[model samples]
Target: MPDDKTALVISAHSADFVWRGGGAIALHRAMGYAVTVVCLSYGERGESAKLWKQDGMTLEKVKTARRTEAENAAAELGVTDIRFFDVGDYPLDLGPDTRDRMVDVIREVQPRWMMTHSKWDPYNTDHMNTMRFTLDCRMVAQAWGHNPGQKVLGAPQLYLFEPHQTEQMGWTPDVFLDITEVWDRKWAAIQCMQGQEHLWSYYRNVAENRANHLRRNSGGQAGGRAAKYAEGFQTVFPRTVDALE
Candidate 1:
């Protein structure tokens, strides 16, 4: 681990982090890790239907609403730092300065591990594009020759959180995290996303379902640990261990 135990999460939209990795953020924060979340965009254009449906809704107003919700959610999850790029969505393009800024964050945090969306998403190009840009920035941050004086990053495993529709997104989870203790915190964070009210109970159901999987995979024998709520993740890089349990 670095001098400071840190972890980074890159989200395509303002609320993506909460819906996808809120449990992980809370669980890790409770474990003495500083979790930093970077929201690439507010998702105002594409994902803010509820806000847009209201009368006399402007872009700035929607953005403000989205930012407020994310900030509250981040607090609920005990996030150490939360940054917003304020980049427009619905084809979320990385502005010229955005990539360098992201590199700066990666260098600053020096996270031991990172999290983001899956490699592909049929329904949302923004999700996949964000993943691509995150990986690209990570590669740049890891190269000592690129920035010279700036701190270069070490090898950090990137965990892809569950997509909205995992079956259609080709996401297969290999890691199941038991977030039973922090489930309440995650639920509070999920509630912060009032813009996406429809997904509240949906994600709760997902946690319950993943807990079942966690229970079965944790050697479903007599007296196995019971996980009441869990979150699943897919590791992008193969982990190296000295010995098997």
Candidate 2:
């Protein structure tokens, strides 16, 4: 509903977007871009360790808590829309229906840019599987023959946000977004992920480390910008431009 200026984030789990790209979401939203996040699953089975440790936590209870957390996080991040597929995680899959649904969302949003998981994640196959499904669904959305009446999607830049373990995940950052101004918002969103309390400080540290990288690469030690918080991303496709910035 925000014209052609929209961004889509295809996350494997409810909290994946928060940990990996909350700053990017908040930053873009502040720049007048409508950010929409899609969570493939609640991450109940694998990622909700805190909730599971409770005295008696049912499957539905875990799902509800995860959903509420995600919604609260999205609001804090200034997200325009947050969709939950609720397909379940652990070993995330993209069945025919799910694939079609993703394609539909792509067409509907007609995003100018998109973000998703890395191509590989040894620690969590669900993260890798999400990348596969995102690419597959994007292809379907681009094909005019798939759905005659629907509009075909344009080639949008897909950026892979930082994973928990970038070393093993083989993710290299080509862009570092200075999110100091919106750091508080990102922190608030991070707090909404109560199920992963242990990661709160971990991700905050990641942001600070990325800010250091931003400062160094931006101007070196002598003239480096003073960015206190930042988010890193790896571009999945080559960026084309007529002139260098």
Candidate 3:
């Protein structure tokens, strides 16, 4: 645990973090938080259709390409500690070993907050499964009995980032973050995902739309905070506050 602020992102796939939480990651980094991203898989088997279309492509090659793209994106987002679990994809292998590894990371980071996928995603079970797995890891990390003499994790707010087809996923944003200052950084990171080029514009549109929502919620035309770009999140737990403003 460092002396400064810290946060963690548990991404189901290598590029998931970039698409979903890049702006938040960049904005927090600017605010002096050491953001650690953990990619459970490269999404090579399921999400590498474009790479597979290319001739002479192999599993390792796809994984390598995806990893490189993730690294590039993470760098653009100012994330220096991006980790890849290499557990495999299509259906992530979230076994005992993976759980233990994730628990260890949770304990090590002791993040003030965490981010992951939505609770439900029928389109991609991997995404939903990852969210559940992350929750389990968080719980284990907080248990003193899990690892004797190891530092236990503190309670951290878990924010569920926006998912594709938000309505279908049953995801409603309770928090809208104005990431106008870091939109350019997020855009640069989004460009690094060459494998999923089709989604570049889609996510950009998401940011813009979310920004509109932010503006409306802030105060509408009556002295609303102007935000050009933003990100939305659904909190899994209730927030404790001294007073409701």
Candidate 4:
């Protein structure tokens, strides 16, 4: 574990951080990385069965509940800095304005690595927009493009997390992290969703399936992969991870 590693996870919605990359977040925290999560929205419109079912569930109530859920979930992963950006919920607009906001955040954080969805996804408009924002943010940082009013930031290494539906979306992961050691933490973190039981089960199964693939593909890392889970990621551009001593 690195003593002073900083990680930033930028998610389209609150649950994406938990359901998709929970293990990675948890493992990073456990390994002593300072994990910061940027949740674009509270997921009020697209999904909120649990809170909606409650009597007299207002928008404020849903926002509060989701915020608490995110806090608890991220806490499980030892993450302490949570930026709950009050962006739109589901079916988010990835217009130029949103791109500007993303660029500003990138400039402020100046993170070494940024993870978002692959630009190839089709079903989820929000996912596609997220990729656009990430790419645009990079271009703005590198001064390859203009993001008026946003300070310039250095280009960061970029990564694309695996899409939940790999086949339908045609996601191909070139890198997979053996998160076997952190699977339980991932599961526990996801339980905070509290809004969807069936959805949680589906994600859990996905994690298991990814683990199976890891065992077969880990090669030398295969020794510790049995009965473990993993996460896959796709990269858009070449990355240079500086070796720090």
- Top TM-score prediction, candidate number: 3
lDDT digits (tens) for residues 49-163 of candidate 2: 8899999899999999999999999999998599999998988767999999999999999999999999889999999889989989989999989989998999999999898
Q: Compute each candidate's TM-score over C-alphas.
A: 0.97, 0.98, 0.99, 0.85
Model 1 C-alpha lDDT per residue in residues 14-38, reported as the tens digit of each score: 9999988999999999989988899
How accurate locally, in lDDT, is each candidate? 0.93, 0.93, 0.96, 0.75
> 1 or 3, which is superior by lDDT?
3
Task: Quote the RMSD, in angstroms, for model 3.
Answer: 0.7
Worst 10 residues of 3 by lDDT: 1-10
Instruction: Report clash pairs, candidate 3.
Output: none
Off by over 4 Å in 4: 1-4, 144-152, 220-227, 239-245
- lDDT by residue (127-212, candidate 3, tens digit) is 99999999999999999899889899888999999999999999999999999999999999999999999999999999999999
Itemize residue pairs with steric clashes in candidate 1.
Answer: none
Q: Is candidate 1 or candidate 3 better by TM-score?
A: 3
Give per-residue CA lDDT, model 4, range 1-245, as digits (tens): 12236666888888887887888788777777777788888888776777788898899888888889889988887788888876876677667777677666666666666787766667677776877777776787667356556556665667788776778777788777777788777888888889766688888788787777777775536474565678888777775668842
Per-candidate clash tally: 0, 0, 0, 0
| Candidate 4 Cα deviation (angstroms), residue 52 | 2.0
Ranking according to lDDT, highest score first: 3, 2, 1, 4
lDDT of 4 at 125: 72
